[model samples]
Target: MPSFTLPRAARITRITRTHKIAVAVLAAAGATSGLAVTSAPDTAQAASEHAPAAVKPVDAKGQPAKADDAKTGRAVTASVADHVKVDSVAKQHSAKQAASRSAERPAVKDYPLSIMKDKGIPGSYEGLHRNIMRESAGDPNAVNGWDVNAVNGTPSKGLLQVIQPTFDTYHVEGTPNKLTDPIANITAAANYAADRYGSIDNVDSAY
Candidate 1:
């Protein structure tokens, strides 16, 4: 029965081989870890360069502003258009009102002195002329402002100094209705004279 141990030198040689194999494995692992740590910053920098830039808001005209600015511009334009339309309508209405006011005023026309004879009234030119000159100095727009009729607020008016009542009652046709109209005043006074005093030629005084 032989039981013998390995020599001491052989044991030492085996232990040295084991220790070298472990050291080589640990060195290879350390190198791989260093390579991973060193390449991390370069990978991240490349990824950032290749990535798309951050998107910014833009208007409808492709300008670099808020997208809502386009809507605000459209609203402002619409408000201006509405204001212009209202102003134009108001101008047109004012013009139409002015034209209506102008249309309401009547045009005055000039009449000839011989209108009484032309219209078949019973009056002579000399008698009418004398009466006109004595009453109002041949002025068609003459008024009796200090007379009894004037104090009563119905002042005598026109060439023959006829009051409003006398003028309206004996007004001649085919002549201007205004009391200041020379031919109309003459014809009306002449007709009144003919009705009361029988003829305009017979009258000489205030009647």
Candidate 2:
């Protein structure tokens, strides 16, 4: 048989008909999914606008659960910072108040002038001699074996009978560190008495 071919007009008409059929099929598919045929770029946005609301989380009582505030984290951080700042300020204020109280107390001044000048201490020789007589009778190497301090392993020694820790703490800057040195012991004891009772002369009892 000889090859048969459609005329040019007939071929064009067939192609146009096939194109229409394809477009119709695409339009039907797009309509079910809310796609825009005229503006393809806006298809997603248009579909979202018409989409159903999402299901919400529910509580045990079937009420919609409230979302946590985004600022909750910041609020907690700010609270901690504020608490720390307040605590710091309070501690500083307490320290200042204690210092002020310490500064307000007047130092005792019952020492004799002659002893103050002779011993190079600002306290009375009478007070010093009295304490020495009572504590160790002016013995530089006197050691208490029955006292509470001795029981605690920090027995008082020296003419002024100061413990090692006390002597070390109140030892004059230029004085020898020996606990039995007469001048060092007396000076350290006088200094401790001055700090505690305002002056060695103010202490008439065991101190």
Instruction: Specify the highest-TM-score model's number.
Output: 1
Error of 2 at 17 (Å): 99
How would you encode candidate 1's per-residue C-alpha lDDT over 45-133 as one tens digit per residue?
A: 88999999976645434456544544456644555577789999999999999999877753222133355556555666677778878
lDDT for position 81 in model 1: 74
Instruction: Give the alpha carbon lDDT tens digit for every residue of 46-144 in model 2.
Output: 889989998665443345554642324454445557778999999999999999987785332222333345556567767888888988997889999
TM-score of each: 0.43, 0.42
Tell me how far the alpha carbon of residue 137 in candidate 2 is from the true structure, in angstroms, after superposition.
0.6
Question: For every model in order, what is the number of clashing pairs?
Answer: 0, 0
Candidate 1 regions with alpha-carbon error over 4 angstroms:
1-115, 118-120
Pairs that collide in candidate 2 are none
CA-lDDT, candidates in order: 0.77, 0.77
Model 1 clashing residue pairs (backbone): none
Ten contiguous residues with the weakest lDDT in model 1 = 105-114
